[model samples]
Target chain A: MAGLLDGFLELLDVLLRNRVRTVMTALSVAWGIFVLVVLLGLGRGLENNVRWMYRDDAVNSIWVYRGRRTIPYQGHPVGERLRYTNRDHELVEARVDGLEKISSRFYPPIPDSVRWQGKIVAADFRAVHPDHRYLENTLVETGRFLDEADLLEKRKVAVIGVQIVGTLFGDHPPIGEWIDIGGAMFKVVGTFRDVGGVNEESQIYLPITTAQASFAGADRVDQVMFTIDDAHMADAVAIEDEVREMLSRAHGVSPADRRAVRIRNNVEEFVRVQSIFDMLAAFVWLVGAGTVAAGIVGVSNILLVSVKERTQEIGLRKALGATPGSIVRMILAEALLLTGTAGYAGLIAGLLVVEGLRRWVPENDYIRDPDIELSTAVGALVLLVVAGCLGGLVPAWRAATLDPIVALREE
Target chain B: MIRLVGIDKTYRVGAHPLHVLKGLHLTVPPGELLAIMGSSGSGKSTLLNILGILDGYDGGEYWLGDALVKDLSERKAADYRNRFLGFVFQSFHLLPFKTALENVALPLYYQGVSRKERLRRAAEHLDQVGLSDWSGHLPGELSGGQKQRVAIARALVTRPRVMLADEPTGALDSVTTQEIMDLLKRVNAEGMTIVVVTHESDIAEQCARTVFLKDGRFEGER
Candidate 1:
């Protein structure tokens, strides 16, 4: 232990004496680690941004939209348009296994304006069953969402979004107050906030039955959305095929015509996005490791030059009773000191920069706070240490194998 | 304490091999102050290298004390050298980065001696060499003779059984050479086995015995 301390002190003095060269070599390593860490953080941020896009919607939900028929069935013309009705929603609910929650949405044909206490604001209005709240990850801020009784009674009740409340009601409490929508007066049952964003927040919702009866969309829905059990998410493509078949048979369209029935499976989209991010993460690691390897190579080159320059000194040490093993140990210690110090500096700097950006960057729909995992940071550190060892190996071996006689003769 | 019989050494330069030492025989008894004198290309340095265990011979039987020193592994050779030999080079090869005291203590460091004990011994050796006050100075800051004294101090701190000085005074002025020779004589008086390799007759005359090498073989002894 005492000998090791003495050797370390000697190494420190040696490094201190060649401060400029040591610093330059260390800076190259630092730059490499810094670039690697920063690039990884950026990659993580991009992945987070993609994930944030789905935060407001059910990841397991699938959306079926009405499309023009591309294949003729039951004597119907191929070009006929298909629209989903309440019966189709019932058919899907009864036929599809692993169904979690199902809801059909109808949007009014014309843009509607909402009025409360003489204040008015243009809003995008949609009519939906109560399960739409859960399917869209909508949070009810005040009062309750539309219930099954409201849908069955065809009650004239509405759920207004926070943005609409801000626009029409200002600071006024909106619950139990009457709001006029497209010449129909409905009592505001609840206020909601959509995780999607401000664009989604400016909309209003009503019970599907009431909207179809009151407006011109009687018994008709433009979109049907349903979530399945998460256990079935991996087999979502197969489940989507089943749903498509059922829809085709019920609507008198050919099952083979993909374009005739449009379905958007959020489970499949999430899986695709997740795989893409995984690839991106792996790519980031590869590039980062390559940069670190380059730095390690630079360290190795510097140490080789150092070994060459110190040939006579090494010879003198050997003459003074230094073993070949001791010489190798000394060289390896120097390499570790250089790389470890520089790598940690870069790590701290990278983390600080990431934190700074996270604190100052504005929140948007795509990106939230950008940062890397703790395990990744530690992994980089371990890689740097290993690289440092590798960087020292060849030079240390050369120094160890030096012939003391020839080395002394060098000067 | 040292014996070499029928030693042979060859050097490879490109393709052709040049024989440097051929069937050389020499011995040094304990506590002897001996010198080997030769001109350039006379294989005196090669013989010194073999004696110092820095190079291996092609064919030889070398006995240092009770151990046969031929074809030993590098680790064992280093151990033998550390335990039995101390070397002083022509240029006074004190490490430039270390203080005189640290350089003197380095041999003990290789022996795994604690810092306090090695430093104390190094200081004692420096005092013996009349360089105690200069111990803190770096080799660059010291005069040539002072550097040589520091090197000698380093060589002595390990308390090896043999001291090998290769051209120890070659780079010194006449006055400094005389001073160093006097120091070596003082060390010899204290019962140290000292071998000085040099070409100058005056340096050789300072030793109790001088051997002349002509062509990788000893020609005569004075």
Candidate 2:
């Protein structure tokens, strides 16, 4: 321990003697680590914001909406529109292999109203199967959602959104209570919340059979959506193609007419955007590591200069019984000291800058919560120290291998 | 005590080899003060290097006391240099950044001496060299003679079997060179074996024995 302290003091003196050079080398190292931390934080922020954008819906869902045929098909004109019938939902559920859940949506042709105890609120009403709970990311706050029994019996039951309850029932629980919709009375089965915010929370749900019989949707489904489990873009695209082929064939739509059977594959889109972020992360690391490497070159250069300037002194030391290993150790210790202190300072500065942005800057759709994890920070610092050691290697070796006779005669 | 038998050394200067020492022979018994005199290219420095174990010989037998000193590994050679020899150079070669006390204490440090003991012995050696008051001064702050005194103090602190002085006074003036020579004579009187290499006849005359070199061979001794 004493020897180590003595050696450390010796190296400190050497560094202090060359203060300007040490500081310059340290600044370059500091900049390298700072750039790394900031870029990583930015990449992570972009990823967080994107994930948040899809927070309200299942990431792997495919939503198929109504479309008009833009191209003429066999015996059909180009302007003819296409509609999804109730049979299409059964066929898709049976034919799709990777699907985890499926739901068909129906809506009243015009905006609707619900009245309870003379409290009137205009809101959206959706008719869907029970699986719609998972697709819309809804949390049933109390009571139950539409079930197989409700749809089978065509019961006059409703699952009300939390906002609708807030407007109509106020503080009262709406379960098992009656609400009037379009002059028809339905019992409230549940009150549910959605992360999709007020618009989704204001909507209400009904069994497909009950809504069809009441509002005359002609046994038709206005839209279809399904969730896939653990499949990537390729699997989602394949499922989409199968549904399009089935629908287009039954509707006489042309094979090349994509607009007639519009499909939005969230799985594919989500995977594609996530991969772009992955590339951005790789790019950030590359630029960060390259900057650190350039700083290492500066370290190596300074050590070489230190060794060159001390040639005669080294010769004298060797003659005084200083071994080659001791010489190497001394130089390496100096290099480590310079980088360790500077890199730590830069890391703290970078983290402070990121924290400042997180607190002061308003978040948007493109970025939120710019930061790095603890493990990443520690790993980056370790990498910087290893680079510093590598930077010292050549100079230390050269100093150790010097011929005392030659070095002494250098003057 | 020192012994050299038929030492041959060659230098590779570009494509051609320059033979510096050719079949040279010499010996000095214990406690002898010896001087080797030669002009440049006569291989006096090469002989000193061989004696110091800082360079290898092409062909030779060198025995310092009872130990044969040839073909030793660098680590072993360093140990031998640390334990058995001390060197004084023409330039004084004191570390410019270190104080006189620190420079003198350096050899003891390499010997694994602890700091307190190293400083104490260093102070004693500084007193012996008549520079105790300048022990805290850096080499840059000292005169040429004072710096040489510090270097001599550093060399003697280890109390090795032999002290090799390679043109030790080449950088000093006439009066200071005399003072340095007096210090060396005092050290020799205390029974430490010493060898001084110089081209100056006046410096050679101060030694107990002076050997002249012509080419790589010893011409004669007076």
- lDDT for B88 in candidate 1 is 89
Judge candidate 1 at residue A343 and give its lDDT: 80
Query: How well does chain A score by TM in each candidate?
Result: 0.75, 0.83
- Model 2 Cα shift for residue B145 (angstroms): 2.1
lDDT tens readout by residue for model 2, A192-263: 999999999999999988888888777889899999888545587888898898888877889999999889
Error of 2 at A265 (Å): 3.9
Q: Which pairs of residues clash in candidate 2, taking residues 3 or more apart in a chain or in different chains?
A: none
Clashing pairs in 1: none
lDDT of 2 by residue, B1-222 (tens): 999999999999999999889898899999999999999989988899989989989998999999999998888888889889989989988887788999999899888777888999999999999999998888889999999889888889989999999999999999999999999999999999999999999999999999998788899999
Model 2: residue A347 alpha-carbon error in angstroms: 2.1
**How far is B102's C-alpha from truth in model 1 (Å)?**
0.9
Among these predictions, the greatest TM-score belongs to: 2
lDDT of each residue in A143-224, candidate 1, tens digit only: 9999999999999999988998887887889999998888889999899998898988988999999999988887998889
Runs in model 1 lying further than 4 Å from the true structure: A53-61, A66-87, A90-102, A106-134, A140-191, A197-222, A227-246, A253-286, A361-368, B10-19, B58-60
